[model samples]
Target: MMKLLRLCALLICMSNAWLLQAQTTDSISKIDSLRIKQIIQSGSTGKEDNNRNVLLNAANNTSPRDVNIGLPSSVGGITILENDLPVVYFFWPELPTTTWRQSVGLERTGLLKMNQVALTMGDLGFAVNSYSQTGTKEFKFKSRFTTSHYGWLQGDVNVSGPMSKNGWTYSVGAFLNYDPSTYTLGFARNAEEAKIFRAGITKYFDDDRGKITLNYKYTDSYNLVNYALFNYQTNGQVRELDNFRIGRDSYILSDGAVRFKDVRSGEYYMANLTGNEVTSSSHTINLFGNYKLENDWNFKFSTQFRSSKAARILLPPLSIFSTNAPAQSGNTYTIASTGERYEGNVGTQLAMNTPPTPLTTVQGRFSLEKKVDNHFLTFGLLEQFYRVNQFVSNRSFFYQTAEAQPRLLIGPNTDEYGFYGYNLGSEYHNGIENKLSIYANDEWKVNDRFNLNYGLIFRNHIVNGDYSQTPRTPDFTLQNATFTDINYSWYHIGGSANATYNLTRQFGLMADFQYTEQNRQLEGYSLPEPARTNKIRSPLGAFGIFYNNDFIQLISQATFLTRNDYLSRFNLVNPVNASEAVATTTYYDIQTIGWTTDFVLNPFKGFNLHYLITLQNPVYKNFNFEAFGVNYNYSDNNVLGVSKVLMEIDPSYEYKKWKVWASFRYFSDQFANLTNVLYFAPRWETFGGVSYKLNKNIDLNGRVINFLNQRGASGTVNGAELVTDASLYENRLLTGSYMMPFTVQFSVGINF
Candidate 1:
């Protein structure tokens, strides 16, 4: 921590090594607007040293950027942080968005819906949105600023002397990010705090045929604190539900005062136990590293290791509502989660709160890749192990104030309420994965008559996790000891192929096909085992043409995508999670297809046009996490974007000296989670700014985004929230991180 503080202190006294916008009348009057094709972006280096000439317009509009990844960096190339998504319906730097890596890579490593993506223009990259508030009240937005926005300060120092002559570079790099908007799930008053550090080294060896790359990275989002919010519709509306089991049956809580199982328990401790401990320090440290080989003929390897431990204060995976179980209407109830005393369901809704569990995941990764001539081949063999020493709560203060009911002491022995708190004391998980793929790609330059650019991909995947929940269980109980004994294996074979033949210089014919098959099975006697298989795909066939002006730089392609067998990571769960499998014995499948056309036209100077039209039908699948029943899926997504040179409105202003632009988009989901309801979210994202002469030695500039703020829906979803039909009240949330409102920023700086 002290090291980080010291590093931050030095930043105020230092200036970046490079500046992107060096435009000035004296600098260049002849080169006004840069062509679209000329812009370039280098991910591994500084600005000018790795520059491109993509002109950007200030005062830009809001629109969903294309998800395509094959386009050069000038188009779109932003990574999303799924854990923290923007509040608005559009893209926000802090909100959850999709990562661009999936659009191009053969594999995805993170959660599917959590990452936030950024769009880039030329050497500059930024995201815009309509709503920007992180909370569930009012709308607030942070301006879109390049350079300092998610940009990392990275470089390496190589000290190999003459050995560096062979390009044998051994390097080290570090970067830090401080964003108040990225903190606390917006539940707390303060923004989420994030800190990241990365270092790596490379060795060029074996005549350049083999280079060794090693890297270490760490990221921590901590010190997050938020108070409970009490803004029910009309304050004391008290929409309550009682989930009870009359007699011996178990019923989900919905209508208040419902009965539960035959409540039973052992005598509680009669002695007073007052315990308190304090130490000056507590922390969690995780160390991770990976080794990679530089090879071309299909050979690669990588390994990783990580270990972590947390402070003792976070102990106790407890929640308030979990403590109060029906006590036969008379017996003293010993609560495990919240110790708050309760007579009935009155005055109780006010105290209801979710569990506060903090996790410590220590994981490792191993991967390999290979390619052979016309056919590309890759394999990822991984063994990841997680060591969880203890489960802690981030809400210890809340628990401390509610000790009215006999509370549960963290330990081995406990009742039903206590057992829930003892979900997992300490355990380790060893997950193994094997993934293989092969593809053939090539572009046939068949005169000016016809052209073909396409390939095929085949993949096979299998995964197994070896671990257990709580190791200790009471005797005579059906036990689930070593999860290692329960095996889950899923196999998948997928491939994609496309061909585009140029019929004329202004038009072309193209078609593409994709297919995937997945099978899942579990191995265990006590554990239920189910085998299931599913095949999914997207059939895209389209024909179009375009003109290219290598000078003004204009190109366009109008093609259609017939999306078939659309699937989500969770939706594609072969056998689904264990508990779910035992309940349904069936899998979730999305077998519907949709068709959409995307057109990109960049004509004349300093202008570009992009639009998409999509239509889809409903399909049968489980909605949300609940296996209530299968239903048809319905929805539509439409997007459009246009960029123009601000200077075009006034020739007096040099194009390179000033800029402005705007984009807009709309998305409507009639039935969210396949439930019967209309959910619509519309967004207008825009960015506007210009460079002004603040004297010969200084310049003034600024930008704004999420100006016309509006969010679709936001609410609670922490397991129990489902009891009161929380999904029904989702649209009532006033603030959300999904849509950060619009805001503007201005800054003046010296040229030197």
Candidate 2:
């Protein structure tokens, strides 16, 4: 803690000194509009750099999250969009893990476009376009090879040029990535691996004002699921284990395979934990075009068709207890395939697997825009269709707890089916979803000192599906079950209004308000009888002031947001006994009021500093649920996985052909569970890098992640939902995820 404080103080002192010196200098001038736009778009004053694009958007003051790694990201506590379209798969608004990683390769992207508006008229009005074309005619070729300290290697090659003299352009790229986990696992060769290929062709017409492009992408990926287990005190302080390093050791077993019946088919099969990996694949095609019309009018259209398959294989810990506990007697725990008693701390884990499930989707959008006087108006339509066939099977297994490489165990209660208890063949879902949206927006310049923007949107959502699940009963068996039909529909209307007033050439004031309505998602259809509740409503309001100069630029804003009717599901275990558990669904609401400030300081020549700070109170309201035939109310609890404060400071210096930069991010304490009793301490994630432009066609770069080596846990605590009271769980064991350890990466880039 002291070290972190000292670092913060040092940075602040340096910034103040630089600011004073810059103010007294006679070389400073007013910042130009082009430079301001660059800062707003890339979060830096210098040329675009992938390493500096850490914050998703400077306006919201939030960072991007990796959905593949079980992290959820939001813009002002709301779901974000991709290319002005919702990225929904099943119930969540996140694309399949492999699809995102493959489509957005490390070195394939030529440009990143972001549109942020304080309105709900355009599908959240905050979207990121990551797949824009290069639009280059001259020959261009680029390749990069990167190696990490942990023996991971990644590489990509891209080339684009004119296919023919008759206005045809083409591009092709390939990427390969291999990443072992932060901690090496004895049972797996690599924790994550991926291969991606992309190709595109474009034809220009009407002097480049009109063009059509067709693109194809393919991705194959594999990943391993793992986490860390530790003990915690009543005060929410984590306890270190004797032989296990929190961020440098893994507890997955080498011989943890299990036999289980398929959810859709009754045939039995053995699922291996070693050598074999969970794999997924995807194929995507995109067709898009835009044309400029006469009389200041324009037209644009885009369409996509995708067929993909996703695989799931997880061994999530449910509970941990001592061997001498009351629940371990009477031959309750024994060595796997044997009758010998097992002695040690034991962890109950759910071995869950789902065969590669098929998914197909088609989406299209069309828009028209016109400019009249000081007003710019746009009208658009969007349509999407998705189909998914999924099946999941689960079995319970016991393992002796250790710092690394545990051994599986079986109990007398284990049935002939090779599972200890409950939910043998878990779930099956076959579903189809359709969405249609119509929206219109207008931007008007009221005067030289005043501007106004407003928009309205309407959306229709529909779902049709068949679902079934096994009952959570002891000694359950895989039974042939029939599926149930599910049919539902919803209508939504939303809009926003925004205004900005420039008081002077260097200062401005702005305010905006937005509102939207949400409905039940398709994932809820898996239940035999889905819950019927009021439409979830979300409302947001913001007010801010901005100032810009040659030495520094700043924007400070205060925002209030409220969202209700949230739905979630969890499987909780009895703390006293590892054999007993319950599956539950919960409904809740959240309200938050936050303040955010973004700063871009060019205090001296060739030196730039970008800083952002966010402080917010995101708390639950009317959070009530039922489990074990008991009602639990946790109103006024802090929202899980959300910190009250977030800060990012990045500073870079450029001199001739050499550039150096560092980024420091700090997250305050966050609640780890619904009860708000378990929490993770504050932590810092620091990164530093240096690059040398060795001639115009070659570059050398080196980067270090977690350079400060702060080894702390992140994400939510596993299976702690039943611990509503903290006093009873003092000194009890807990299982959760840990941050990545320190590592270094070096890369060589070649371009011609």
Candidate 3:
């Protein structure tokens, strides 16, 4: 088609230009041959800037070229380029083609399509998106048409240039964006998602002898999620301790402690945690920037101003307690009492009049980073001002959720709210997060055959929220049992490092380690919870060799890793002396060690092969109040296997005429999982696709995703419906839940 011919023509021209550039590079360095280089490089040997810039440009190809002066697409066919091109950085680059840039801050881009490979400087870096994919839920059944997903579109381009004439190096950048809005429900339901458009301009100032910049961002994000989305909803999500898997039907939990399991390990872990609804709105304009002094040190300063609001809410009337459940014949009991113990046994849900919920949060962060010849370091301070309509509710609720039922750890009683009650409307949170981090990285180059990259990151966080026994409230006002009318803080520090050292032209070793220590901290409890130190250390590594010729290229890697998880709930009869009375009813920990391998093969320019393998040893430590359970601790270990393969083919003979890409995976993680109960993950999630150039101005694309049948009447004993799975899925008992039928979408892009 016409599109193919045009693409082929561009390729030919680019190929010729490439030859010219190559010949030129051998002749003389492009930018360095000029004046600027002699200064920045001072007296360096290698005058390489053309190819360097080209390669760097390719790595940063995220922008699209503009067509006209300042108007929308005016051509009926294809548009022309008039402005700068986007720079993109790909994980792997075998083919030089144009793909749309993802959202500003998100890993996924927008759904819009464009044919012209015009690259333009992207929006300012701090812009947000205002679109969501909240299907049947957002519009309700009547208005619902098709399911949609949303993302916060953020990204910026800062082009700083050095002017030796005026001894000034200036950076001019701008940010434009639209961010989505979302809301969460209290129980087992999902929240609604929306979006808002924001725009801002920022400019920096600096001189070659010094580095300084002053920047500001102004934005108004509308249609954000608020109290309305929370107070009323037909169905919501659930709250639990751990291990909840049901696929799509799984509550679309965001930040909840429990959630559905993906097709990864045999069971759920942190990677699978969801079920939190986030809804925020405000006008934020920050005049913030940084500067570097002549002493090789940097001093950064900034001040932010903002207006924010939240929806009104009622405090739920429920209390959590650790009491003996009805004794069954087979049930085990370590305690003599058959009676239940509670922190708040109030029988009634707060029977009070309702008023709209309102709260505000204003915060700021300041930091400094020092650049060492071989290291990069930074430290900072944070502060936030919060004003909430009700402090009593916010203070008491955190206390109960963190302590009330220190024994069962989790059960129906805990779900009802508190450890034993259901009303949670009473707890409100208005807090700020302040944190700092210092990090350093080094790229070691010994010779042409080997290279190594090492880094270390350290950080600390401080959070402050308001609490009061007699805070302003329309109803549900009671003496807060714990720290009412006082401010508390939680502090934690974590660090991580990754290293890669090449042994040969195509072979090397890589490793990473991260540690987080958050002990001696108090969480939200009916009373301040016990302070205990917990640490998580994870290390990952891989080694591989590659063989390559023009016709065929192959790579194989051996990957290994280890991870840890820990959780402990405390029980205290007293409201204040939390540290001493801590029963330490349950101390949970999970440790895992595993290995994985990946292989990628390219027989030709248009075709590629990809594969992966993973093996692991996972152990879990568990304890619960049930007498049948061990009062001490028990660790369960299991091994699991996972593998995958991907393929893509683009015919050179056809030029840009027709393109096809397909990926299939054979994955089985159950072998290493220890799940005899509860619904787990799927065995596989496959993908396939094809895009053809019907003509020069129009192209067609189609895809069949998640080919395997996972939504069958499978998995759990009772037949459960697939929640938000793929379009086409096979339902198998014990298998994961299926989404919908098959989903097929066709998009068209035209360039004149």
lDDT-wise, the better of 2 and 3 is 2
lDDT of 2: 0.63
Quote model 1's TM-score. Answer: 0.48
Report the Cα lDDT for residue 496, model 1: 38
The alpha-carbon lDDT assigned to residue 35 of candidate 1 equals 15
lDDT per residue as tens, model 1, 23-97:
121124210111111111111111121011112222111113333211111211232321112111112111121
Please provide, for model 2 over 1-752, each residue's C-alpha lDDT reduced to its tens digit, 9 standing for 90 to 100. 35323433543354344334333331232000001111221112111224334332211111233211001233122232333333334422113445544232332321221113323233332223345343347888878888877777878788888988887888788888887756667667677777878788877765656766677878787666667767776665677677677766777765546665554555566776542325777787766666676555676666666667666567777777777766565555666546566777777777766667666666766677787887888888777777675544444454555446676666555565436554442545566777777878787777777777778878888877766644544334436455566687889877877676778877888776777876775666444445553688877777888778788887777877777876665677765555677667677887777777778899899999988777877777888987766778888887777777777789999999999998887778878887787788887778889999999999999988788887667767787866767776677777787766787879899989
* All candidates: TM-score: 0.48, 0.85, 0.46
As a whole number from 0 to 100, the lDDT of residue 665 in candidate 2 is 77
Indicate the TM-score of model 2. Answer: 0.85
Clashing residue pairs in all predictions, respectively, total 76, 0, 120
